[model samples]
Target: MSSTVVETRRVFEVKNLDVYYGDTRALRDVTMDILEGQITALIGPSGCGKSTLLRCFNRTNDLIPGAEVKGELNYRGQKLYGKEVNPIVVRRRIGMVFQQPNPFPKSIFDNVAYGLRVNGIRDRLNERVETALKDVGLWDEVKDNLKKLGTSLSGGQKQRLCIARAIALQPDVILMDEPCSALDPISTKRIEDLMNNLKEKYTIVIVTHNMQQASRVADYTAFFNAEALDNGGRVGYLVEVDTTEKMFHDATDERTRDYISGRFG
Candidate 1:
């Protein structure tokens, strides 16, 4: 008898997931399993629900007015959308970094310390901040400017600070929505390296339009595409999910192949 072994353990299990904004369906029946301690990139053109799917992992979509989500989304076998689940608690466990760097106007130290404070972690606050900064490779650059306003830093520095803020909580997973989209090529390379290092400690899910970035950084890649509806609109859905190597070179889905080849976004 032959048997198959699943080596990668799943952190998030999504089944038949659908998201809606008012009456318009944004995502439809998107289902995939995200592995723990690995980088999974969501790649697609704009308006294809890449960000929507990213938000579903931590329930950030709940904060959006008129947004509704259906189907099963489980975090480590726990019902993610259960009535007993607290969005605040969920966010702490699954932190997020946005498209643009959005550090608070507070001091660099305080910005990284913000989540720890909100979680009432007063002990060793400085140590935790320092560790988080070090994890993102920002400690050497900003160690002398700990008291400086976070906003005073350069764009790349601000992004690293935001990453440090998220890492301070020691989150199980980190959701990044185009984190390097607004940075220069050098800064983008730095963040890519940071992502590779972070996967040793945390699972990462990123929404990116850059195919090269996905191919370069992700271990697994999921392709999303929009389908036109009869009502003259569209709904985004998952087209394929596979190892980065296979997805780029041997994708089974034609849609995925076309998208990866730059035939169509």
Candidate 2:
């Protein structure tokens, strides 16, 4: 008797997704499944819609004027773009950490507690804040400096603070857009290690131009590229997606192979 291993549950199911800003198409027909409790990386060149696609996961695109999205995006089998869905609620469940560490100009503790306060969660607030900080490996460093301003921390600390802020909400999925782009190599490695550890509790999707970074921390990878449209503008689209090992060593698509091999982005 042969027993088949079941695949992990999918967290996000995107089908033929297209995103537009005004008349310009930013991303076209992107379809992918994000598995639960794994790190999925989006790697591509500039103007290739990696970040645009990440925004679609939490409906952050809706905040931009004239931004339109076409096609289906489901979160845990529910329609993410459904009229009945609330963007605020969606964001709460799908947290985001941007390229820059934009911690609020508040105390370190307050930064992590902001979401809890907004959600009206007062019970065990201190405990929650501490746990969040510890989860991101920042508790020991900032435990005594809880009252200090978040912006006063180093670049690496600031990014971890932002991460603590997100994880404090206990979101099921975390979207990161070039999270380590501005940090030193040591800082970048710290973030990558945190990502590896965090995957046990949360599904992560990251947009990165650093091929090595993607290869280091991602379980799955999606490659995207821009094409010149008939209107003379470039529109980004998915090229290939596969297990990180497969994508790096044996991608079926020539474009994916070339991009991963340093021939072209």
Stretches of candidate 1 off by over 4 Å are 1-5
Candidate 2 lDDT over residue span 1-265, tens digit each: 0011046888888899999999898999998888888899999889999999999999999999999999999999999999999999999999999999999999999999999999999999999999999999999998998999999999999999999999999999999999999999999999999999999999999999999999999989999999988988899999988889989999989999998899996
Residue-wise lDDT of candidate 1 within 1-265, one digit each (tens)? 0011176777998999999999999999988899888899999888889999999999999999999999999999999999999999999999999999999989999999999998999999989999999999999999998999999999999999999999999999999999999999999999999999999999999999889999999989999999899998889999988889999999999999999999998
> How well does candidate 1 score on lDDT at residue 120?
95
The Cα local distance difference test for each model comes to 0.94, 0.94
**Against the correct fold, how does model 1 do in TM-score?**
0.97
Stretches off by above 4 angstroms in model 2 are 1-6
RMSD to the hidden true structure, all candidates: 1.9, 2.3
